[model samples]
Structure formats: structure tokens, C-alpha cells
Target: MRLNPYGEDPVRLATSLTTSPPLTAEELTARCVGAGVVLEQAATADDLAEVNVFLGRWLRVVEASNPQARAALLNELLAESSAYPRLTDHAGDGWHIHYRDYGLPVARLLRALISVGTALHLTGRGMHRLSRCELTECRNPFADFSRGGQQRYCSPTCANRDAVRRHRAKRALAS
Candidate 1:
């Protein structure tokens, strides 16, 4: 069976958008396609504006202080964006389930895809799977797809930077 497209990929796309927001509709469309999303239509300026709005709300879900708060915030997105699961061959690879209505505009499609994908990801993985990078200087959001669910940084660069900082601090303290 094909890996569930409605889960990890959408969350990753959401994280990317939060990390480096696209400045134009064409740019947003490019980013989505790069992230493996099939936009139902060319992204419009409204789609660009509204996607920024949705990502702001999506960040609230990422920044929630606790699991309950996270769930509550994600649920609000779900309530606002999702619909009953429907089987789709829209991509024509094979039939699969989609958590949104087909033929939605780009922004609305993204809102649905990310929200439902997030719900699936958290439920299937763990509630703690969504988080910000641990490094103080780079607090970008990341989905913890690590098998152990122990991801603490957005990238190895951040992890290495934080480690070096800690090592230097310890050396200073010892000296």
C-alpha cells in the first residue's frame, strides 16, 4: 500500500511554510509542489494571503503549551477545515482516502490537507511529535518523524550548534 499521503507529508509542508513563508502566490505554489502537494488550481493572491493567515493559526497548534492544549488547538483547525473522509483517484496513482472535499481552491485545499494531516500524524505517532527546535536561537517548528520520537531540533545543524554551545558553556564553567 502507498504510504498515507494525508499524514506526514502535509505536516512537513506546514512546517516548511511556517519556517520560510512564501512571499508570492507563485512562490507558494512552487513550495507546495516541491513538498508533493497537488494544488487544485494555480495559487491566487488571496490564496497567498489566506495561507499566511492559516499558517499563523497552524503555529498556535505547534506552540501549544501542553498536549491537551495542542489537541484543543488542532481540533479547532479540524473543525474549521476538515470534511468526511472520501476516496479519491484525483492523483490517478490509485484510489486512496482524502480528508477533504475535492476541487477546493489552493488555500482551502492546503488548510484542509495540513489540518487533517496533522490530526492523523499526531494520533498515529504521538502527541509530542510536533515541536519547536530546542536551540534558543532557532525555534522553528518541526514534526518529529524520528522513529524514537525524540527529535529536539529542526535540523542537524541546529543540534550541532546547540551541542557546541553547551560544550563551551561547560568548559567555561569548569575553567
Candidate 2:
């Protein structure tokens, strides 16, 4: 069985892009390269602009009101971005499956990767796996890679903060 390239990596990359977005095309290119994504072309200013817009749509998937809404939004992305499965050996790493066509620009490439990756992550894990932090101050979106499927915050810092807050509230109520 082949491990599809569109898996956990893209969703996490999508989360990172949506959370602390790159300010420049070079930065975006650097981030993608850093994340182990093969660059078909170097990102340009236009690519950065396009990706920013695409990320807004991606965030909608994260912020959907319910499971159906979430699936609907993600379906929109999948329909708009991904293509029929294709085979590739990008960088000669070995033959693997790709969901987008060859030689796409950075913006389109990212859209395909993020959309397909998010779908795989949600379907394989749980719909509840993709979510924003529960902490009101920091609503960062995260892909819950937890074993228990009970992630509510974007990070441990936010989780611990909320826990402390809850504990303090309970103590105050007791007092």
C-alpha cells in the first residue's frame, strides 16, 4: 500500500500558513520548502496574494459551524482545487500519488495540497480533529494529532492557561 503524499503534512502546513501567515513570497517559499514540500516554481508576489486568499477559504473550513457545514466547505475546496489522482516521483524520492496536475504554480499547488490533506486528516482521524483553540484570546487552528481525539486548544500553553483559569474559577466559586 502506498502512503499518499497528501496527508498530515499539508493540513499542518495549512494551519501554519493560516495561523502566522508569511508576509512575503520568499518567506512563503521558504516555509513550504522548510516543510518538505517540493516547489514546482518559486513563489511570486502574485502567488503570495493568491495563497492569502486561498488561506481565507481554508480557514472557513476550520471555522465551519458544524460537521456538515465543515464537510460542505471542505468539499468546495476539494472540488475547486484537487484533480484526479496522478502518479509522480517528485525529486526522485520514489513513485507516489499526487492529487494535482504537474507544474502548478505555488498558489495552486498549495490549494491542492491543503485541500486534499485536510480531507485525508479529517476522514482518517475524525471531523473533530481540525479545530480552533478553545482559548478565546488565541483562536489558532490546529490539526489534532492526539491519540484520544480530545484536543480543544491549539497548543499546550493555551490548554494549560485555560485549565488554570477554570481551576481558579472553581476555587472562587467554592470560596
Best by TM-score: 1
Q: Which ten residues in a row have the lowest lDDT in candidate 2?
A: 1-10
Task: Encode model 1's per-residue lDDT on 60-136: one tens digit a residue.
Answer: 99999899999999999999898898888887888888888878889989999999999999999999889999999
Across residues 1-175, which tens digit of lDDT does each residue of candidate 2 receive? 6567799999989999988999999999999999989997899999999999999999998988888999999999999999999777777878988999888999999999999999999899998888899999999999999999999999999999999999999999999
Best-fitting candidate, scored by lDDT: 2
Q: What would the TM-scores of all predictions be?
A: 0.97, 0.96
Would you list the C-alpha lDDT of every candidate in the order shown?
0.92, 0.93
TM-score of 2: 0.96
Ten contiguous residues minimizing lDDT sum, candidate 1: 1-10
Can you tell me which runs of candidate 2 are displaced by over 4 Å? none
lDDT of 2: 0.93
